[model samples]
Every structure is written in C-alpha cells, then in structure tokens.
Target: MRRNTTFLSAAALAVTLALPVQAQDAPDAATVLARVGEAEITLGHALALREQLPEQFLSVPDTTLFPAIVEQLIEQELLHQHKADDLTRRQRSMLDNEVRNFTANAALSEVAIAAASDEAIAAAYEAFAAEFGQGEPETEYNAAHILVQSEAEIEEVAAELDGGRPFDEVARERSIDGSAQSGGDLGWFGEGVMIPAFEAAVMELEPGEVSPPIETQFGWHIVRLIDRRDAQVPPLEEVREDLSGEIQREAARAFVEELRAAAEVENLATDMDPSILGQRELLDD
Candidate 1:
C-alpha cells in the first residue's frame, strides 16, 4: 500500500520532535522497510529524513520522492565505501571533533530517554490536565484579528465594519501584524495560548461576531470569531511524541540530579570579582 503523505508528515514530525538526536547505528534499512544495495533504510529512518527535507522537496509527489531519496542514499553509501584516506592534519582534527561531538550527543540522548519511566510520564500528563482546568472541554476559537497600535485606527476599522465593508479588506489595509498577509488568519488555538486580555475579548464574542476593539500589548485588535469547537483531549496516540520528549527530559534531569547529590563538587571561590582577570600580567612575560 502507498504511504499516506499527510499522516507520514505528522508521524515524521513526531519522531523528530520526540527524539532530536540521531544514533550512529540505526535499524538496518532492509529489515525495517526497504533497502537500496548494501545500505539499509528503515521506515523510521525514511520518516526521519523526510521530516528534515526542505518544504519544497516535501511537496514533490511521493513516487518521484521515493526513488530520488533512494538514489541519494546509494550515492552517500557509495562515497562511504570509497572514502579517500589522505587528509591534512587540520582536516583529520576537524573530522575527529565532528565525530566526537555527534557520538557524545547521541549517546547522552539515549541515556536520558531510557532513564524515563511509565509512572513519571503518567504523573506529568495528570499534572498537565489539571493545570488546564481539566473540566468539560469547551469550545475553542480559531479567530483572527487586525492589530493596530492606535485607538483611532481601531475606530476607523470599526466604522468600515459598520458600513458593510469586508473585514478582510480593512485588515489588509491597516493591520500591522504578520497576519495581515493572509488577511489576519491566526489559525486554530485554544485558551491559555493567547494573552489574557486577548482571550477575554475573544471569549466574550459569539461565533461569527466581530468585536469592536480591544487593547493589548500588541495594540488594539478588532477580532472576528471565525470558528469555535468543543476541544477534545487528543488521544495518547496523537500526542505520544510530545509526551515521550517530556518524559525523556524529566528523566535526564532526575538522573543528573541524582549523580550530583552523590558527587563531590566545590567552587574554588565563594566570591570573586570578574574584573580581576583584566589585571593579569603574567601572560605578558
């Protein structure tokens, strides 16, 4: 069956976001998905690669995308197979440093993630739910607004609205925000994501109702509630990647803390003026 590009895109993002570091030795390509020659390419690896590809490349049809990536991988493997050994001292040193950094980062990430436990993740989820006021999920607005720095501009826009002029037209004419490009499409967002003042203004308006004007740090906004819906708790399957990262980060911190408690660490000076370094004259000798 052909892979679902959109679903794969989301999955690819999840994998990348969940695990930012790449392991030196990954699952063999043939065993995981399909392979090209001696080089193994797994589905996970493909997905990871697809995530990192440029946006324009991502838009290319998968039929073309797949073969192209295979060819690219084969070329890389071919180069690896016949890499020249001759190198200047500086070149070798640079190579050594690059390899060392890559290995260290990958190994540390693995250790951090592995240290996480099921209980810890569960606790974190519960805490997050509680913080969001885990009451019955309410309707969330996916609205947009044209922001202006002055009340006069806000009133002028309001007048245009009163005169039956399309809000989008006025938005394009006067909005100072980046949203002006798309006629102020802020896209889907839930409560707590926006500033309190903005949220309050949005909450007061009924769906399809446009507000007169509201002020916030960004400036005055004339918001239109484009759409609203009863927000649902995303299934664990939907948000597993984010949860995994959170668990990994917490585990890493806890592990580091435990080690710190068991180790002997001391600061050489209780207090030292950094300016003292400016007076150093021994190096002149």
Candidate 2:
C-alpha cells in the first residue's frame, strides 16, 4: 500500500523524539512556541522536530535549531491542515502498516534494553575474555613472499634471492601476485590467516630465512619471515561499548527464539507460489 509520504514524515518527527536527547532541562510540553492560524506549535513540537533532523544538522546549536524547527513545524502544520481530507485509501492502509511496524519496533527495543543489563554485560565480557583474552599472548607474523604460477618460476625466483638480489626488487620485477608491488609484503597477521601449507612453511623459518618452494591453492611461494610478536588484549573499558552491543543482540535473538518455540504459528499461504511476492499489483487490493 502507498503511504502519504508527507504524513509519514510528520509522524517520523514524533518517533525520533521518543529516544533520549542531549542533557538539558526540557521545558513543559504545553509551552506554546508558535501559532499558525488556529494551530499551536509547542516546545514539545519543536523538540520533536529537532530530533528528526539529519545527523549533520544535529551539530547545529540548539539556539539555532529552536527557532528554525518551530518555523518548519509551523509550515508543516499549515500544509497538513489544508490537505488532511485528501488522503487516499492506499495512504490510509500504508499509515496503518507504518503504525504497526513502529509499535512492534518500540516493544522489541524495550525487550533489548531490559536484556542488556549490567550483570548480563559483565557475564558476556567474562565469557569473551575466557575464550580470547587468555593470559597467553596471541602471536602475529610479519612476512613477505614471492608468488609464481609454476615450480620452474618459483625455482628461478629462489635462485635470484639466493644470489643476494634484493627480494623487493625481484618481486617488483617478476612476482605475479598483487603484493608484488609492495615487495610481497603481507604485513602482520595472526594464526589461521594464511593457507595451511604456506603458514606451515612460515612457522618453520626464522627472521631473514627464506622457505624452499611451497605449493598451495594459489600457486608456488618463496616465503620470508620478517618478524613476529605477541598481541595483547585491549582493556575492558576500551571495548565495553562494543561488547554491550553484542550482548544485547544475543539476548534479543534468544528472547525471540523462546517466543517462537512457545507460540503457535502457521503458514496459511503454503500452497501459494512464492513468486507472487514480486507482484506489486497485489498491493492494490
């Protein structure tokens, strides 16, 4: 169903205001800020308009936003009053759908908020730390390679390296892979990052030592171990916000699964062709 975009836009203004705003003692909702004919725009109306503004516009100072939003609301109210009776059947249906969608969203948001409590977050963080933040440091490798399409080409490259020709210079001249431009520098990576055959070769080498020709899915490679180090886990405070978000998502999924399992649901359209979903004409009915 088609909705009146203008009416939805107005309703969105109210929805945005339902979320928390910047810290300030908000004025009473009844405080009238403007009058367009018999219509009254109050402090609450202006606040809702401010909430609906784009992210870039939010950086605009409240002193600037207050008067501007009031003016915009005044214009919107004037237009809405003039056009209210002209709404189509499709517009009404769409409005009903929008209301249902927003109401469900609001309820789900409350469930998510409640699930992501302080205790839940702490437990999630502890589980994460146990799995990945063990006291043993995570190892990372810094390495380079020369890749070629065949054993013959890899052997030729190895000869060049063995003869003391610079790896970067030879890579720039002959290596077929994209990293050839960067002297085959793969930079730093952790375990499980590289192909098993290539990683095995790398693990066996010391700094400045090169691997004999190794074959993998990609091709043949002569690898050099540049350096290696252990990576430390970041402090809890540094990742708390991200961790909290993950906890909330997991909690919401579990809640939904529980509801689904406990509830009776049926697919009434079992015999209908799925392709019918693409028929926009169905919306007309």
Candidate 3:
C-alpha cells in the first residue's frame, strides 16, 4: 500500500521534472509553477513544502517530489479556498488553540536547542551533582521495625530498646508486622521512592539509632535504621536527555516570567459564572 503511495508522490514531483533542478541550476523561488482560479503556487512554495515533507515522501526522487509537492499544495489551496469564510465559533476556537500550541512549542524548542550547549550541560551537571551529594551515590537503607497496635505497646518496645535489647531480637518478639519476623528489614529502595512521612522518619535516623515513637495509619512504629549502603546515580552522559529537558523547562519558565513582567495583563472574569463554561450551545452561534 505504501509503495503505491510513494510511486504516486514521485510521479507528482516528477511532473515538473522535465528537468531536475540540480543544486547549481535551481530556478528563482519566485517563479510561478501553477494556478488555481486566481492564486499562483510558486517554486518557492514547492521548495518550502518539500522541506516540510514527511521522511517517507522525502525518499522519493526530487523529480517525483517536486510534482507531488505541487499537487499537494494545489489540492490544499483548493480545499482551503472552497471553505466559506464563515468558520464556526468552535472551529475558530480550536484553530486559535492550535496556533498557540504551535507557537508556544516553537518558542520552547528554540530555548531548549540553545540552552543545551556543552558548557551549559557541564554547568548543569555540576550543580546537579552538588545537590546530589557531590556525586556520592545516594544512600539506600536497610531498616527493621516493631509495629504495635497502641502507644502503650510502642513505649514498651522503646523501653526494651533503651535497655540494650537488639533491634532484630526486639522486632522478633515485639513486632506484629510481617517484617518483624525478618526484623523489619525493608531491604533497599532508591530516591524516587522519593519521599514519604515514614521514609522521612527513616532517613533522619543514623544506623542503629531507634526513632521516637512514630504514629501512622498502620499503628505505632518503633523503627531502627539498621544499615545503609550507597546506590548508583547515573553518569551525566546517561542522563543528558533528562538534564536537557530540565534546562529547557527552566529557560522556558524564565522567558515566560520576562514576558509577564513586560506585558500589561488583566483578568475580568473572576466574578463571572464559571458554570457558563459548560454551555455548549454558546458556540452554536
């Protein structure tokens, strides 16, 4: 099916193929190639459309592509001009959204392309590494806990802990939770298990230190940070894509802020009935 389409594209491009416009012999872009009613499609239009062609169409010979592009532009113009001037309110709204989306994306692309220079990425990596403990592998902890149904039970466990009972021993005897059997060992998890109240409490404790009683939905927890080990952080090259996106986002945010600071803006709809947004018939007119 695609082969036939390719053949057709090549044929369309070749229609003007009486002579292939080699790089040296290229005609002026302003030269008109065809007419539809009163509108002229020029060589410039064909060349520009060819630049935007999808990869599959590009593989076709320039001879084939030239005619195909011309055909495509002519057909598109005909369809566009055939449509009445009276676009529906909904259509105009959608077209406005598309235009905004394209322009905003193009602006962001420009920022992203310019921001990811080698020096910029290197700088970003340095900052990132510093924030990430200066390239020290992040630490993952092995922990054990005694979970009990009440504050009273937790205090008992704390007393036993303070009295020098081993955490795993205490866990074996006092923890009603499953890990109690394993001395509450949650083996290893990385950062984007990112954060949580339970994890926060865990992080604050030095290995072998017992936490003050922590209350959670499960019950009271007497947690011990048993041991911790370093977890790998990817090298800069490995995470270049992620860092590039971050750079792009940061640049985009700064650009938007500059625009906001320079522009005069007003919002007059604050008191209006937001429910009116649901009225579909409003667009019918």
* Model 3: lDDT to the true structure: 0.77
Please, what are the lDDT tens digits per residue for candidate 2 over residues 1-285?
222223223433333222223345665877777677888778787666566666776775665555556656766888888877776666666767888877767767888889778888788778877778666778888999999999999899999998999988998888888989999899888889998998999899888888899999999999989998886555678778888788778877887788889999887999999999788665563
Each model's lDDT comes to 0.70, 0.77, 0.77
- TM-score of model 2 relative to the true fold? 0.59
Each candidate's number of clashing pairs is 2, 0, 12
Off by over 4 Å in 2: 1-26, 35-40, 59-64, 82-85, 132-188, 195-201, 208-242, 257-267
The reply for model 1, stretches above 4 Å from the true place, is 1-107, 113-139, 235-241, 261-285
**Model 1 over residues 1-285: C-alpha lDDT tens digits?**
112222224323223212222354754443344344665655565666676676777787776665555444444555555653756565566677777777756766887667555666666667766766666777678898989999998998899889998878888888999999888879878889999989888888888899879999889999998888888666556666677787777767776687689999898766988787686453342
CA displacement after TM-score superposition, residue 260 of candidate 2 (Å): 5.3
What ranking emerges by TM-score with the best candidate at the front? Answer: 2, 3, 1
Over 205-280, each residue of candidate 3 has an lDDT whose tens digit, in order, gives 8987889998888899977787788865559997788888888889889988888899998989999999999998
- Listed in order, each prediction's TM-score against the native is 0.49, 0.59, 0.56
Ten consecutive residues with minimal summed lDDT in candidate 1? 12-21
Predicted model with the maximum TM-score = 2
Clashing pairs in 1: 29-40, 29-41
